[model samples]
Structure formats: C-alpha cells, structure tokens
Target: MDTSGSLSITHLIFNASPLVQIVMLFLLGLSIASWTIIFSKSNSYKAARAKADEFEDKFWSGIDLNNLYQECIKKGQDLIGLEVIYSSGFKEFVRLINSGPADQEVVMDGTYRQMKVSQSREMENLESHLATLATIGSISPYIGLFGTVWGIMHAFIALAAVKNATLSMVAPPIAEALIATAMGLFAAIPAVMFYNRFVSKVEALENRYINFMDEFATILNRRLVRVRSEMNMKNNDVPQTNTQQPSSSYSQKSYNHPLGEEQHSPYSRARANTHSSPYQTPGVEGDRYRNTSRSPLQGQ
Candidate 1:
C-alpha cells in the first residue's frame, strides 16, 4: 500500500464541499466550546463540593453558633454553597434576636426564608452554562447528520453528470461527509456524559445544602426556645414589692373608717389592719374576725 496518497484530517476537511466544510467548522467550534465548558464546570463542581465538605466538618464539630457565624463572615465571599446558606441564616437569626421583642417563631421563619433564597441563588450559580452543554450534546449529532445527507446528495448529483461513475469516485465524498457525523458524535458524547454527571453532582450538593439548612434551623430553634424560656423565668422571678406597698397604703388611708368611730369593735380594728396588709386576700381575714367577734357576743 502506497501511503503517499493517504488523506489526512486537514486534507479531508479542505477537500470537502463548501457546505460540508461549513458543517465541519460549525461542529468543530461546538466541540471546542463544549470542552471549555466541561473543564470549567468540572473545576467549579469540584471546588463547590470541597468547600461544602469543609464547611460541614466545621459546622458539625460542636463549635458555638456565634463563632461559626463570625468565621463565615470573615471568609466573606469565599464562602460557597452551604456556607453561604448558613451565614445568611445565622445572620438573619442574630439580627432578629438582637432587634428586641424576640419572637422565636418569627425569627426562625425569617432565617429559613433567607437561607432558602441563598440556596436557590447558589444552585443557579452552580448550574450555570449547563443548558449550553445540553444543547451541544443533543444538536451536534443532528448537525453532523445534516452535513452527511447534504454531501451524499451532492455526490449523487455529481455522479449523475458523469458518463462512467465508479466506487472510487463515490466513496471519498461520502466518507468525507461522514466526518461531520463523527465530529458531531465526538462532541456530543462527552457533553452528554459530563452533563449527566454534573447534574447528579449538583443535585447531591443541593441535597447536602438543604440538609445543612434544616439542621442549622433546628439548632437555631432550640437556642431560641432556650433563650425565650430563660427570659420568661427571669420575668417571673422579678419582685413587685415596690408597686404593692404604695397601693396598700393608699387603700388603708381611703378605707380607715368604713363603719365610723361609734360602731367600732375589736373586729373592726382587725378588719381595718387586714385591709392594709399588701399580701393578704382582700376581705377574707376581715370577715373571719367579724364572725368570731359576733360569736362571742351571741354566746354572752
């Protein structure tokens, strides 16, 4: 076999019809773009997963929530995925708590909403350019097939013009046209594979983020409950002695002689003093004294 006449890739491309060449060039461009997206998306997914892993390790390490929130803030924009969700949630939690009149359910609701919004934005960022990959995967093969069909049609037309057509004259153009389909498949396969892989990865990461959000919300809810209980306890334990004393004094001055001096009895004096006592039940002790005094009079 003389290898001197063998066609190279460059030769096939150059020797192809104008329409086939255009198809080939278009497929080539798509291939290049898909590979570029693959490399970039590969790096992005890897980094996002790594950051999520790191943040989860730190989050579940039993460190204080405040400390974790502070650390994430220090990391600033470097925080990705779950870290961003955690930071946004905790920040909102703290803001609502510190702003006074802390309603635990309200705070948690706000925090959860903020985290969900952040998660959604992060998912969008992670899924960027995926549509382009899918388009390339689905359309590349059809584009290549179109080129092949056009080349075959052209070849048949040219063959009709010839007085004596042979296999040698027909085979080359058909083969060259098929190269478009080959390029299309080459471009489509990896795009499809990586697209599926990345989609799974993004979903996994998304699930991880959602789980973290739930867990973080649980921790926050517990803390909010504890703080609210503590505040309620403190409020209950507060002494109202100062407020009581003034009210008792006013009552005694206003009602010192309900029956007047002429009708005063030992029971009447006891009743007056009882009414002045701040902690005593109103009228009960006075009624008991009056009944005892009347019983003594009845016995006499």
Candidate 2:
C-alpha cells in the first residue's frame, strides 16, 4: 500500500460518482457565492459605520445646515443618515415658509412631519438587501440537505445496479454527501451571524438619528418660542384702537355672529380663538394677540 499526500484534487473529482460530483459542484458554487456576499457585506457595513460616525460628529458639532446639506448632497449614499435628516427637515421648512404665512407653529409642525418621514425612509434604505442575507442564512442548510439527500439516493441506486456491494464503495459516496452538508453549514453560519450583527448596527444607527432629530427639533422649538414671545410683547405694546370699548364691542360682535361665522378676536375676548389669520387679521396687526394664535412670529 502506498500513501501519497500528492494526490491531485482532480483525481478525487473524477473518481466521485456523477451524482456526488454534481452535489460537490453545487456546494462549491454555493460556498463561493456565500463568501462573496460575506466579503461584500463586511466592507459595506464598515463603510456605513464610518460614514455614520463622521456624519453624526459633524451634525452635533453645530455646522450650518445649508453647509451640512451641501456636504450631505456631495456624499450622497455615504452619508445616508445625515442626508435623510436634512432632506426631510429642510424641505419641509422651505415648503412651509414658502407656502404658509411665516408662522412659527406651522413651520415647526411641518418640519416635524418631514423629519419623521425622512428618518423612516433612511432606516429603510440602510436596511435594504439585509432580507436577502437573512433568506440565504435561513435556507442554505436546507438546500444543501436536499443536494445531499439526492446524491445519497443516487449513490444507493448505482450500487444496487452494480451487483457488488462493498463497504468501500458505500463509504466514498457517503463521504461526498456529507461534504455537501458541511458546505451548507459553512455557507449558513457566517450569513446568520452577519445578518444579526448588521441588524443590530442598523438599529443603533437608527436610534442615533432619531435622538438627533428630537434634539434638533427641540432646538428649533426653543428658537421659535423665544421669537414668538418677542413678537407677542411687541404686539402687546401696540395701541389698541377701541381701548375701553374693545371688550364690550368685540363681545357684541361675537354674540351677533354664528358659532362658525366671523367670531370675535381672541385679543379682546380672551377666548384663545383659532381663526385669526396670523398675518392678515386686523386686531393681531400690532395689537395684543393671544399666545395661542397659530402664526409665525414676525421675525421667524
């Protein structure tokens, strides 16, 4: 008996039964594909993590929004988190200011809506293609099992037709079938591990975006509140036309009007009315306006 470690891999393939050979080939392909995805995803995730870190640092550093937006635009997919936030908040702010009377309340509401939508969209994008990885991880072993089972059945059928039954003949086919199973596990284990890891990373990034959104919105809210307060103070200092008669006359006008009709102004009635046009209402024009008035502060 001669044992040579120099035996060629091709010799092993040639000696394998057709069924086992096919299974081996299929397993090899699967392993290659799995490894390709693994490497691609590993690099992709690393890049994403780096991009997220860089963008968040810049975002929290108090960079100007326009400048930030420009930078995000330049980076595009690289800075997905920052891009989403900027697009959502900035677009809504622009739309609201352009369309609505410069009311702080309206602006803030619109910005909030946009930011929420943007964050959701960004998360979706970040997690894209993850499902494929999950599917491959979950099903690879079963696919390999199928190939193994088919090869084993074919191996038995071949032996039955050969008229000679020997343990030596049986063992090689069984060995080859087991190889398919091993390959399946090789493909599956990494995929499952990576899928779970990537999912956790995505969630962490999403939480960061959300927290930043909340903090940024709060900042805007504070700014808007102060501006609105200053505008209210200015409005209070303005001279009231009717003075002593402002209350009684305004009440009479309200009483004469229907519930949904022209109601009396909130400034005179002190009822916190909702219909007064922030920009066009006469009473609110340089008069003591209620803080509940849904209007952009003049300065904002």
Candidate 3:
C-alpha cells in the first residue's frame, strides 16, 4: 500500500498513462476551440440581430428607397442582415428600369431572383462553424469513454500482479480515468447549446429577409405600373399644331373636303384664286367675276 505520492490534480494528470494523457490533451484542445468559436459566433449573431432591427425600422419608417439604396451602396460590402437582400434586389430593379421600363412581372421576377441569391449567401455565412460544433458534441463522449476504458484496463492488470490489493493503489488510477469523462462533458455542453441557439437565430434572420424582399418587390412593381401609365398617356396624345408635317399626313387626310391635300391649306388658297366660286350668287361682285373667268367654251 504505497500511497506516498500526492493525489493532487497535477499529480493525477502527470501520473496518468500515456494514452489517457493523450485523450485529455485532445479534449482540452477541443474545449479551447469550441469556446473560442462560441464567443466569436455569439458576438457575430448579436451584432447581426441589432443591425437587422435597425434597418427594418428605417425601411418601414417610409424612408425613400432610393436614398436607402444610396446608403447601402456607401456601406459597400459592410451591408448586413436585410440590407444585403434589399440592396441586391433594388440594384437589379434599377438596372432593369434604366435599361428600359420592362413589364412589371419581368422586373419583379428579376429582383426577386437576385434577392433569393443574396439570401442564400447570407444563410451560408450565418451557418458557418455550426457543423463543427455538432461534430464535437456528438463524438466527444465516446472518445472520453475510450480513454477511460484503456486506463482502467491498465489499472486492473497492475492489481492482478500485486499479491495484496489495497484501496490506495486502486483509487489514484480510477480517479485519473474518470477525469477524462468530465473533460468530455465540459467540451460538449456549450457546443450543443450554442449550436441550437445559433440555428434559431439564423432562421429568424432568413424569415425577415424574405418578408422584406417581398414587400420591396411589391413597391417596385407599383412604381413600374405608375411610370408606364404616364409614358403611355404622353405617347397617345394628339398634337395641337404642326398637322401638315409628313407624319401627320395620313391622319389629316382621313377628314377632307374631297379636294385633296390642297383643301387643307396652301393648295386650297391656290384653287380659290384660279376658279370661279361655285357658291356665288348673281349679285354685282359675283356677276363681274363670272363674266371675266367663265370658260372659253361658254357664249358671252
């Protein structure tokens, strides 16, 4: 019963078998990595949520979309949350409108597609590191158990070799083996908890992005219809003057006195000067014009 050595934490770890020590070291590394990711991702999600809420407030507050779009552009790649979806959708809307006013459905389709693409990108960024966390949580306990079993096997073999088995001899090795399980639990709990939390937050963000995009598309569609209506009205208007221009010839000819193009203007005046007026009465002015301009075939 040689229990002279101290059973402090340092002693238990330092005296652990090589395999058990290796398992403990590996678990420590995993715990460090998981904690680092947890803090980093937690801060990232918190900031994302704040940005989304602020942007939604401004969007629904009736701020002009063009101004918002300009602000988003100024932010460049720093745009976050719903801003990313809005920026991408609105950018497509502007480009299509500038190219030429297209059908409402066509423009909306393009804008929505662009928004969906941006949503996918944001989801990818939001989901980062979640799989690693899941893997750590699911596999850590089994790895810890493996190290414990290996350590206990070594302990039992040593007991078999000693003729007199004692409590002190067995206690240190069993305690050393159990510490691996504790480390495994320590690494797993936070990773699993944070992984679920992050997933829920990401889902909330996705829903927000989709809803905002739909509302934005509707706004753009209404604008498209209103602008198209104005353009159609302008194109269909009847000009008040310049009826003699070549483009107006067909329209002007549609309503005539049966004389031709001259009946409308310059031609009408030339004909009146050369011919006797069929509408004349046999008064002094009419008789004089008839006597001077009667056809030569007529008797005087």
* Cα lDDT over the full model 3: 0.71
Error (Å) of candidate 2 at residue 266 is 22
Per-residue lDDT of 290 in model 2: 21
lDDT for each residue of candidate 3 in 1-300, tens digit (9 for 90 to 100)? 226665787788888999999999999999998998889888887887778667766665556566677789999879887889988987787666444435667878998999999989988998898899988988888888888898898999989999999988999898899888888888898889988877777776676667667666766676455445544454457485755556532343321121223354322332244343221122453234323432322111
Name the regions of candidate 2 deviating beyond 4 angstroms: 1-10, 14-20, 70-79, 102-105, 161-164, 238-300
The best-first sequence of candidates by TM-score reads: 1, 3, 2
lDDT of 2: 0.60
Taking all chains together, the TM-score of candidate 2 against the true structure is 0.68
- Best-matching candidate per lDDT: 1
How does each model score on TM-score?
Answer: 0.78, 0.68, 0.76
**Cand. 3 TM to true fold:** 0.76
Instruction: Please identify model 1 stretches exceeding 4 Å from their true place.
Output: 1-3, 242-300
lDDT of 1: 0.72
lDDT of each: 0.72, 0.60, 0.71
List, residue by residue over 1-300, the lDDT tens digit for candidate 1.
127865577777788899999999999999999999999998898888678656665655555565677788898778888888987887776566545454567878999999999999999999999999999999999999999999999989999999999887888788889899999999999999999988888877777677677766776676445444543454466588755544322223321222233223322333434323211222443344323322211121
CA displacement after TM-score superposition, residue 115 of candidate 2 (Å):
2.0
